[model samples]
Target: MNKYVLSLLCVSSMSFAATPFIYHDFDEAMQIRNYPKAFALTNRILNYDGKQFFELGRSLYNQYNPSVLPSRSEPIIPKHIHQIWIGGPLPEVFKKYIDTWKQMHPDWGYTLWTDENVRELFPLHNQSYYDESEGMGVKSDLLKWEIIYRFGGVYVDVDYECLQPLDELHHLYDFYTAYQPLDAFFVQLGAALYAAHPEHLILKHCIETIQDDWHHKGAPKKSGPCHFSKSFMAVAGENGSRDIAFPSFYFYPLGSKERVLRRSQWVREGAYAIHHWAMSWMPINTRRQEFRTFENERSSKVWND
Candidate 1:
């Protein structure tokens, strides 16, 4: 047989020998270049394992299964907020938006780390991962995980606008993030906005996974959501008691197209913040014209208002 066919056979056999439910679908999806679908299936399997363990833990600890406990009933916002800018000075619009958040939560502490600061702060062993990132955007994305892991807090993309005090939602879980579904088979937990306590294993795993597995291929999403999603699933599978998933609408109320169109009306009441989809750090080209236009419009709205 041809080399390609032989490789496929070997991959299929290896997948079959591993966890049947876990790796089979993932391998199939990978073969077809349906990375998103593969990731989604992996996440689903991991979540299932998490839920199972959670149920068992509750039964053993509480002497009753609290399987139906509401995940979002309580708010548990952490005391810290982190934002990063790798290139240079924080833009005027982002500054204004952050100022608004400060006005609403005067007691909370905020830190804006620069590229140099991030490089200085991150662990030395992981420097290669940071350096190998596709661009500043992916580098920034990778840094956020380390920041949140080292110091428990809410990490928000500068492009997002805070609508209210996040403390209420923060109190809900020890580690929390929302899913950004690209399609039925591809659901990604956004790194755009997430909250985690210090030494959270998932955050550590994400950092290490990026360091070990990042191959300098694919889009920024690969290093960001795709990597984060898979790491999260692995963590959830290992420890199942925490609430790791949040509905997408909480952070990303509007879809990618609507975000660019500036459809403010589509903002759901349940949304805690709005991701303006600022692809500002993205490479400039004709296809990204919409990103540029929306960014200009958003800047105007934030600065002029």
Candidate 2:
């Protein structure tokens, strides 16, 4: 046997004899997105192979166990709307808006979605199959789904500040999303969608099926992943509904639709809430800026993920 192989065998033998202990250096690990380290720590605790290991880790990390975790139909009927103001690194402006929104909707749930934390929980390499164009690619979508599954509510980009109460749209939608036609003709601005319906299994199945198709495409027949709108349509079909009810403009402003803002004058007419969308913060040119001044403002509060 080779000398290196003999050394490896000895190490393996010793490792087998001694038990593996799982230790998580969460504080240090969070400094940089230490997915590999987190994965290794998880592996030490569970004897599952690489396949089962990842699923187990994700389940634990997201606090998603079908048996233990509360179901959507359980005691929590959600007295107030659960919302998230997600973006890259949170800005000071966000804190101000969160405070104001909380005051307006006292029972609302608020969460911050940061890029660093997402990467740690769901790495791109781990997704079944990924494509770049589907909002954030398949990997990102799966992570988003995980969030919805765990939290059970609506998600809005931080760029979209609240202007009115969201209580009006308590149970109008089955699966909620920021909808826009590929042509940008009929766009639903702002990220307000309902997901508390019992029939959401239809939407869930559609998402899983598309993910399967992407996974099985194989290297020989590479293709762009399915668009999110297409998947949403699939959900609508499964739920036996012609159209998913999107919250009316009262929840969002006309400027929220990125395309409509360029060609139309809805923004000038005084819309309720503006949706910055993808380019929410970045100014296109001096003439076209994404930020809007708010009349009311307040302080901030901290919450753990």
Best by lDDT: 1
Clashing residue pairs, backbone N/CA/C < 3 A, model 2: 253-273, 256-275
Report the C-alpha lDDT of model 1 over 14-77, residue by residue, as the tens digit: 3221121111121222122433343446346433342333233223223211132333554444
Report the Cα lDDT for candidate 1. Answer: 0.55
What are the Cα lDDT values of the candidates?
0.55, 0.35
Per-candidate TM-score against the hidden true structure: 0.65, 0.45
Indicate the residue-level lDDT of 296 in model 2.
Answer: 13
Q: Model 2 RMSD to the real structure?
A: 24.2
**Model 2 over residues 1-305: C-alpha lDDT tens digits?**
85533543333333222122122221221221323443343234222232232332233323321223333333222333333333334445445445434554566565555555565445333254432322222233444444555455554444454444444333323343332211222212122333443335534553455544443332111221123333443344243332232323322434333345321222222222345443322222311232333211111110100
Q: By summed lDDT, which 10 consecutive residues of candidate 2 come out lowest?
A: 296-305
Off by over 4 Å in 2: 1-88, 115-142, 171-173, 176-183, 186-194, 197-199, 202-206, 209-226, 237-243, 247-252, 256-273, 278-305
